[model samples]
Target chain A: MSSRVRKIRENAYVMNTIGIAVFIALWWLAVEARLISPLFVASPLAVVQVLFTQTASLAQNTYITLVTLVESFLVAAAIGILAGAVTGAFDVADWVISPILDLLRSVPNVAWVPLAIIWFGIGIESQIFVSAFSAFFPIFTNTYVGFKSVRPSFIRAGYNLGASDRDVFFRIRLPASLGQVFPGLKLGIQNGMAGLIAIEFLDSTSGLGFMMGEASDFFKANIVIMDMLMIGLLGFALTMTLVLAEKRFLGWQRRTS
Target chain B: MAQGNSVLEVKNLTHVYTDSRSHVETEVIDNVSLSFQEGKFVCVLGPSGCGKTTMLNIIAGFIRPTSGSVVFEGKEVKSPSPERAMVFQDYALFPWLTVSGNIQFGLMMKNTPAKVREAKVTEYLEMMGMKGFEHKYPFELSGGMKQRVGLARALAVEPKMLLLDEPFGSLDAQTRRTMQRELFRIMAQAKKTSIFVTHSIDEALFLSDRLIVMSARPTRVLIDIELKSAKPRQRSDKEYSEVYEKVDKVITAEVSKSIE
Candidate 1:
């Protein structure tokens, strides 16, 4: 059984490689056969060529975008988790805040972008505000659900074993909630990334999104595609990092029914 | 050792559970009165969902009785205390904690000195036959192993009594049998008062010195009998079979009534 599982895991990576290879081969063929206009869609070779030629600018913009995303996401996560824990732990707080939260969350995060820009003046603050706003709802909602969903048996055991209300909250409820919190953090980061790009299109002088906007205006399809791929790679890397962290922290959850 | 001294007493205890949405109140325990003797392994046998768990929870102080009281060592039991550590059927060992960490939890809650906590953790680990599994998480252990850790954690607190809510119910038959023997051995050594609740008459027969058979809801004590058969009693023997038949008749009647 162990050997078969190991074989399947090894084959998974191989399959992923083959799948990507097939996709790129089809794209290359399409470009080579003039199936699309180069002005609209850059060939894979052209995108790669731009990667080499604009390495310095691309790297700097990528760094800026990454920094903005991380900082704003951290802000959202800290407040969201605190708020979630509080509301989840207390019945009165849940009753008072739940409806208000529902009202605020119903407004699409994208709808906040123009107001954020107006309030914070097209600066980094505007980018942070929009990104943090977008990220907060998922983190808060999921964290609340995480805390609420803790098994009643655990709480009973905690109380029976002499845990005070405070001890049960921190030791039992908070730690148990972590398994659900990670997925929220993953969604938060993705939402923050989207918000960062949207704000960057209107505000930032330095970011992959701004670079893409600038390149597209100049009809540099290759640079535009290259920027999109860089953003995609960054998002994928961030998500993978969260996945590894979740595994590290919630290792006991593995193979759980 | 069933000493004449009582460790705890329930005085006309009754509990009614109310559904929040429906506002319907169900009287689960109806004027039940019982007492646990010092250092005796007592088991409460009843039909399934006969409020056996409710009675256990009240005794554990996890829930308040609608009327009457539970007194432990002359003090009224108002809320959960370390004095009565409970072992849940689900083996609610903190999944995040290692075996040693779980065993050490109650002691840590009491603010025991670090050295004392470490020593108690080590002692319980050895007692539960989980010495090498100290660093293993609950998920890494089998159903039986998890309950052993649960038992160890409860015992490490040095509570006045152990309240087990069908601790071995979820284990497979083979594992459950092994655990019953292990528990018998541990209780002999630890000598703490215990109140074990189970639907299985066989389990109660195999474990308890004093057996309390409860009826279906609204539940009351049907009979409280002393099993004078010696420890490690042979189930095939005439004495064991006789007691089993007596208890089986009471339980089977109750089960059918509940089904009807």
Candidate 2:
């Protein structure tokens, strides 16, 4: 809250606006100068016009993609939390299962696209599986670390207070691990989104990714550009909502920043 | 089995462990044996890294001594139980819980009636001098206040004894002084048999009825002296300085030897 810090932050916002304005100005100039064909990269004005005019279709596709991303992410998160807690709570469990998880997580999720398509027949199940696969790692790894690194004193305190094994996990372990868990969930969301878009691009689909793929095939650069812009906006909005929800749940945690 | 008025006893306790990384064996606690009666404040003083914490943890039943036993109320201590509660140096107040919630935690775990829990929490809140701030989170409180809450939480459970590990070690000198005074007053009110561990000789002299001093790693009792001083004992008193210098001299020598 120092005056200097406040001034610097205000200038940062000003610079961000300037950066956007400059990029758009350059884009318009490039199109006007005919330096590149608009068929490949549409002008900002054309993309915005398309974005506004195709609002209904855009909303429908966006909703479909959003639902698939969210459902998969939720399932992945639930499984990750349970499995992570098990690994974190018991060293034997970690030794037995962690290597397999690490091995599976190491592969690129997009590589599963062909298998998913073959197995689920280009249906929503394949999209969801891909999304879940992308989202699972961050949550799992972070939750495991979170459970492992919980201050020993808190666990001691719980037991000293006569908490049973069950009470320790549900009452002390889970709630205490949540601070570490939130960052993992946040990372998982971003990864799931990237995976969702990549998978959508792979085959027959109804979401924004499919629309973009179809448009690009016919060289509808304006529509493709608008769809890409919509994807970025959706990611931003989802993350912001997550950050707000994170604050509501984990605001009590001591934040270094 | 009833040792008359001997509420707790530590008999021939010894512990050894290897450094996980170094893989070299070391004895952290060497055949330590000591005990205290009910309602007496015992302060443990030792050289740095003297395994005072390890000993306290054993007595709390958080860890078992490699050999020997801690008997409380005629039973060998098997595990951590509500009968013995600890006040930790770092406060250890759950970050996600409010002041009242943290204080009432033991009671909730024990399945005390909500009505009784509410009453006991309120009582301890006032006892620890942290009234009217029940909803504040641990992050909101200062070091001294948070330690007070930690103490209140421990006391709220009505544990038979209290174990404190450097509870005021994190506070500034000024806050430490104030908390020491407050803690002394609160201990007087509860009159629970308590063992406090500290690096400060002055803290030991102020709070303890019996001072137990220990040496560095593989620690053994070097000096066990009864500090017969009345409550609210003056820091500048003749006897106070006498005991302080005696304990300080013994610990200082051990500290030098341990370094070598």
Each prediction's whole-model lDDT (CA): 0.90, 0.89
Q: Candidate 2: misplaced stretches above 4 Å?
A: A1-14, A52-57, A254-257, B1-4
- Per-residue lDDT tens digits for candidate 2, residues A98-141, read 99998998799889889998999887999888889899999998
Question: How much is the lDDT of residue B216 in candidate 1?
Answer: 92
User: For residues B105-127, what per-residue lDDT tens digits would candidate 2 score against the true structure?
Assistant: 99999899999999998899889
Q: Could you give me the TM-score of model 1 versus the true structure?
A: 0.95
In the range A51-152, model 1's lDDT, one tens digit per residue, is 789999999999999999999999999999999988888889999999999999988877887888678787789888989989998899889998988999
lDDT of 1 at B3: 83
Candidate with the greatest lDDT versus the true structure: 1
- Write down the worst ten-residue block by lDDT for model 2 chain B: B1-10
Q: Tell me how many residue pairs clash in candidate 1.
A: 0
Worst 10 residues of 1 chain A by lDDT: A248-257
